[model samples]
Target: MKKVIGWSLGIYLVFGLFIAWYLFLGANTDIPAQLKGSPADPQTFMNERELLLSEEYSKIKNLLFFLSVPFEWLIYTLVLVIGISAKFRDWSKVSAKFSILQTAIYLFWLSLLVEVLSFPLSWISYNVSKTYNITVQSTQSWMKDLLIDFWVNYALMILIVGVLFWLIRRNEKRWWFHAWLLSIPFSMFLMFVQPVIIDPLYNDFFPLTNKELETKILEMADRADIPADHVFEVNMSEKTNSLNAYVTGIGSNSRIVLWDTTLQRLNENEILFIMAHEMGHYVMKHIYIGIAGYLVLTLVGLFIISKFMSFMIRKWGHIFKISSVKDIAVLPVFLLLISVLSFVSDPVSNAVSRHQEKSADLYALEMTDDNKAAVSSFQELSKAGLSQVNPPFLVKIFRYGHPTMLERITYTNEFEKSEE
Candidate 1:
């Protein structure tokens, strides 16, 4: 028994480290030369040869965005199967189940790793952009952006991970049940407080200045039964060139935030159309529905995990560097389970969100009676983000949360045609 435990422990540790190194080290090596940061002057920084290499890299990136998910899953499944098979004596019927667990761990760890390694990731991304003269500034600005990301993400994880672990340990297999229960209060608090607490950690916000824009936004809120709080602009432009706008908070405190980039890039009518779409989400009670969906799924996940808890802990427990059943570290395994559920559940989740976005679009179109403005907004988003002109169907299935640009354009054009 002692020997079995020791061997299991040894294998798990070796495997864990191998996985971590592969994810980080292997990923870094793949950074394309074109993706590396370079000087602003095309002549000074990248010669004609470098320019050609960067262009090739851009082609690869377009391929990468499509290929990344499948490539990741294949590697993930391989590692997971090997890890589980080495640990457990009988992983035949239970192999599929454990694979799911492995996938979950892969995603959570990968997500964290990506975030933790964002410094280099952003640097490479920024440098690549600079090499192509696509980026706005020097490599120093890229470092500052990376630093801000590192701190913001580190803080958010710390704030939530500790309590998340506590919840899993206290409930064990029923951790999902407890988490769902916890999420209720947490969701409420997050709605009311996250904008105040979490938002400020990364960026600053101030009341919107344009009186005409402010009045128009407020009127839309009133019609939608949303109260006026404070409309503000997030200072995201200072960090990166991406454009975004969002509605945050719940009830009386709910505020609309338009990125300064969004304001600059979009016209008043387009802005109003987007706002109306956001208002549709508020009216439909999507937030409340989301809370319910999370609770239900969590309960199901907890029930599944409860059935296999003992075998899991006994088999792969040593890799965690903990002995007691009560040790909080094992919660990572439970978290891995949630991660799997969340990933697998993306299609259903995306469908729900996509429906809400469509509904919002419909509401916006009706309210504004400006089909051209909605089309313009979509065009601006695609241009600003350099979004794929037409993403693959499989990519759409597992990844996108909203309708494709093609779909949006087609739908809006159909509406205009019907009107004509």
Candidate 2:
């Protein structure tokens, strides 16, 4: 346990230093010069100040993403190594006669510990966004949201852990498969209610008050064969300066939500194009595809984890203070495996998302028949968010779910040429 903890902490110390250098000393690094065609090219869409800010801003956010994954994994591993999970396991049984009650008790401490340990990264991310004027959410409100996030996820953890342990105890050998099958409905239920039930907890949503804009969006919806009668606008400007619109939910719960910031910042045509782009997802059934893909990945991931959990328990179970995969103490090991494997699978998932986003972009251009709006809306998006037009390879692979601004703009340019 000491050796494992020592090696893990040692690895992070070295990695943390490199991330520090990359952010501070290497802020001057022209990492995107290759993609941009030249360093600080004056001919770019953004002015000099915006370009410079985007470079630094994008780098910090992207680097933090890379840094946090392993940090989270380490925290999970440390808990198991130091017997925190074991301690919790014992504590959970002290008063709880029922296994479900014990599971909830153990999970509350485990979830709280994980959240507290991982919070510095969360704070650092918030601070960076706050410093850059990206977020307008007050520190008080931010903390409120954090607390809400904690409880919400805690409740979810209780449900998930309860189901998992029940399966493990009842069907030890095929528990992962059974759990994965159960998750299909559970996951879909979450998606279905997310827009109506989950999302409203964080922000207020209302029908687009701009009747003119609402009419335009509704008309576009009609043209696209989308059943949305109302376009919802959420008051996100209170929290962030960024602009966005997205399609969420399924069936009657389906919504194309516009951030109030998007309405405040972008013009009607840009908003229409953005709406059309979002509508493309519904028309193309991307949401269903995404959900299906998630289930498929879960099926595969859980299978691998089951195999790994069996092998790891046999070899290092004693070190982790757990005798078997069914042991409640093995929860941290389960989460750590998930974190590590999910990190490894990120590029593949992100690549698929990017492809779907590009398809939507093409659909928008065709629907709107306005390459100029498509291009300028992307430019406005990049400007408002201080987004990097061309990101580095690592960021592209791991962080980007949509095409970079440069790639998006290039597509419109190609469309314009074809029309000519």
Candidate 1 TM-score, true structure as reference: 0.68
- Model 2, 1-420: lDDT tens digits are 789999999999898788767655654434345546432232456788887787778778977887898899888888878888899999999969999899999999998888888899999999999998898899999999999999999899999988998898888789999999999989888989999899999999999999999998899889988887899999998899999999888878899999999999888899998998998999999999998889999999999988988898899888777898888989887888888888889899999999999989888888888887887788888888988765766668778899877778877756742364
The local distance difference test score of model 1 is 0.60
In order, the Cα lDDT scores of the candidates are 0.60, 0.86
* Per-residue lDDT of 132 in model 2: 88
> Best-fitting candidate, measured by lDDT?
2
Minimum summed lDDT over a 10-residue window in model 2 is located at 34-43
lDDT of 1 at 132: 49
